[model samples]
Target: MCVEKTPWELVIDFHGHTCPDIALGYRVAQLAQREMGIRPAPDSECLVKAYTQSCALDAVQVLNKATIGRRALIIEETQHHIYQFHFTGTQEIHQFTVSSDVLDHLKALQHPDLSPRERQNKVLEGVQYVLTLEESAFCQYDKIPGELRKL
Candidate 1:
């Protein structure tokens, strides 16, 4: 029998590679969707403000269908794993940040001693480790205080 991939599995394929950041983004997006009581963008009906230009951005685009081309996804260069999603036609906004422990693991993957091949293997392992985490293990959602501006 043919097995169906979950939405996040499809996100992994669309992103062309797996990493801890992307996995964390996937979880964050899911949390935002659930909290905002919104579904994936059927068109260009939502906007995403991602505060980092990392692999996680690709997952956000894929999972939320919020692409820069559609003026629905905005990238801001920052040092944090923060993302805010706003559904068009409503004041609802959802904000999330990856847990510090997960971020520490991602930083550790950048250790200079590892060879290129070793780094590659370590990244794969990190991705697997992140994928195995329960929802609360990788991210924290913050109360949406106000509108998030694009930068």
Candidate 2:
């Protein structure tokens, strides 16, 4: 008999490691899909614009099927954790920002005194913490202006 893996398990495999950032991204991708009422892209049909480069980006690529190589993902350098998703067929854009409280929690997880292995373990713990959170707890949505919206 075969056992089915949870979506989080698939996300961890695709992301190459487990961390809070990846978990956060997984949640964000899920929320985006729910809000837009869209399924994962079959190919390069969806575009994701991320405001910062982080472990979260990997999860977004995996969960949304939006990849940089396929021109379905865009990374913009910024000091914020904001993401925008655009679907080709509907010309819809969904924008989201990580909540400041969640950001503070993530930042507090980092420590300078821990060994490398200890740090890794702590990050994994952080991932678990994030996984336990409610969707509305970690992020907030931003309204997109009609003029700036694009498919």
Candidate 3:
């Protein structure tokens, strides 16, 4: 007998601040349960929060320095993540996610070959891919757009 595994989705957080992390993290947990049937232990919150805080600080520091130095913003876009985290002097961190769906929607918007409905479907698929990325907690920055996607 062969068992059929469900296809998984990816997660990407886009243009995020720190405070949103908690909520998004919780949501991700819930989504995982519903979609993947993976029940993360109660202590999972601690791990999620830790990751959220760290990423937020890094993003913030980079943005701040770029602002003062008049350097080009250091944009880190990977296929895996859309949102990031950062901190400032005497400021608490925040968290957020862009949802993979959003990027897929953007990609569909950029593509001319598909019908409206097809493009919409593509967007949905892309968003799902991003969600998987988030759940794994591994982010890859600086992913260039695929060559075929270049306009």
Top lDDT hit = 2
Q: Among all windows of ten consecutive residues in candidate 1, which has the lowest summed lDDT?
A: 37-46
Query: Model 2, stretches more than 4 Å misplaced?
Result: 1-4, 39-44, 143-151
Q: Model 2: per-residue lDDT, tens digit, 54-81? A: 8888888877888888778888889688
Over 1-151, each residue of candidate 1 has an lDDT whose tens digit, in order, gives 9999998888889888777778777777777778877544654276799888887877778777788887788887787888888876565678788788988877777778889899888888888777777767877777665654443
How are the candidates ranked when ordered by lDDT, highest leading? 2, 1, 3
TM values, all candidates: 0.79, 0.82, 0.26
Clash list (residue pairs), candidate 1: none
For model 2, give the 10-residue run with minimal summed lDDT.
Answer: 142-151
Report RMSD (Å) for each prediction in the order shown: 3.1, 3.3, 15.9
Q: What is the lDDT for 76 in model 2? A: 81
Q: Give the TM-score of candidate 2.
A: 0.82
Tens-digit lDDT track for model 3 on 1-151?
Answer: 9765322211123233222222233344343234323223432211111223323323333322222133222343443433322221212222334445533544444567889787666655544444445544432222222211001
The local distance difference test score of each candidate is: 0.77, 0.79, 0.33
